[model samples]
Target: MKKFWLSLLSIIIPASAVTFEDNDTVVLLGNTVIERAQKYGYLETAINLSARKKKLKFRNLGWSGDTVFGHARSYFGPPKEGFDRLKSDLTELKPNVVIVCYGAVAAYDGQKGLTEFLAGYETLLSMIQSSASPREIVIVSPPPAESLGAPMPDMREHNKRLALYSKAVGKLAQKHKLQFADFFTTLGESKGLTDNGLHFTPEGYQTAAPKLVEALGLSVATGNQLQSEHARKLREATVAKNKLFFFRWRPANETYLRLFRKHEQGNNLKELPMFDPLIADAEKQIEALKKTTLSLK
Candidate 1:
């Protein structure tokens, strides 16, 4: 429970100088924080809002309680098997920009696993760079846990350890000359934001999203704030579109998709393909909407 709470607090959504290009397929990979990002659509909306081009694609592939070595995806096997799954997905996505977030769970080991953690991180980075041949790679540092004078368990200690891990991430980014964003250094005064000291409240994600946009490229446009009805609808559409994509990426009742359970419900696999068209429709809507929003600004 301690590790889980502390891990949740270690968010790594980042801002960078590398803005999205027209042809870029931006892929976000990480843990629960990344999964939760899709619900509010703040981060994706901000990235799209800051884009200087049209037809950019965004894919979020974050799973809860994942580790640097793909532990969460292990699925009752060794972590290397999960890493292979990650490799396969990235290869298929062929993303141009891959933004990675990890280090919270690794921090749970404290100083003991820091070295191994970094090594796995480097390995993961190298594997993706080699396989995906991505034009841009960005590493994000996890956000620190905040204590608002509450009787929290060893949060101070957890944060202190996470700080060291974040530093290691920055140093690795520098070595590779990749873009880096340190949410640990950013996200000031997180008290009363994240309930349970880890996961993001919708408001918490809303607060962090623009900062993430700023870290990725240009500052978020004032129009992106939804101060106007058009902006509000556009933003709302973006969220709705993201929700559809989520189903496409992570469908429910996955026990039928593959493995032994397919014998009973394999026929449903054909139904899963239907989501592709829905996802495409949402993407098209976003492209059309982005034009109106851009013109309005």
Candidate 2:
């Protein structure tokens, strides 16, 4: 009888492992914005949020400075060992949702032709779909580039061409019945949320994160700060240190530190000049955290 029970338990354990292995995974592929997500802690933030919500596993496969065509070309080159490596990577991961967010580097005229670009993109998507059998695919449009530094002659034309390309991608999404996120429409304005013209600032991600959550059909729990407690504390300390070290604004540092601490403690509403919508969102997030804490008890 004891032997029978042990055998049953062993079978059950492996079956459970198989079940967990079949759980959904989300893959994000893009350029520096997506890569910076992991570097600057936004990916961590997304993971925390997903864990709390019991959503799909999130994976970042962003390659810095890589455009769609560049990545495609790399798959055929000695560097990437070509298409075989890409196939192997995708097969091993077996993601459920694949989010594609490239085109910044491809926006350059010398590197892009609309016909060739579309053909390559289509082939890539078809290959992934057939090989990996992911449940969904999401194509994200690149945001408008800024005009801060000396403007290139092709800058405006590049943006215009990319916009057309985005529209074409959207059409493909419709044809394929895939999910599409028009980030350009959401983040195109000069004053929308970018720090530089191209790369997203923390504030930019803050605005974009919620929209992404909504687009993905994840639960929208308001009031919980997007960042972890440790990150929040570190950010506060860094701000304080910078003020004292670089600017020598001791009095302002004290005030800023006090406000940051107060904000951390969920006791303050006074806005600092540095407090953007992202910080505002963080304050709201604290409220959500408090509620979750109480509920857990």
Best by TM-score: 1
| TM-scores, all models, native as reference | 0.87, 0.60
Q: How does candidate 2 score on lDDT? A: 0.53
Question: How many clashing residue pairs are found in candidate 1?
Answer: 6
lDDT for each residue of candidate 2 in 39-109, tens digit (9 for 90 to 100): 44443343335345333444556657765543532422465443454566578678887878766666664
Candidates' C-alpha lDDT: 0.76, 0.53
Q: What does candidate 1's lDDT look like per residue over 106-164, in tens digits? A: 88798989899989998999989987999999888876775645575547777878778
Give Cα distance to truth, residue 165, candidate 2, Å: 1.8
**Alpha carbon deviation, residue 193, candidate 1 (Å):** 2.5
RMSD values, in order shown: 4.9, 18.8
Candidate 1 lDDT score at position 253: 62
Q: What is the lDDT of residue 137 in candidate 1?
A: 92
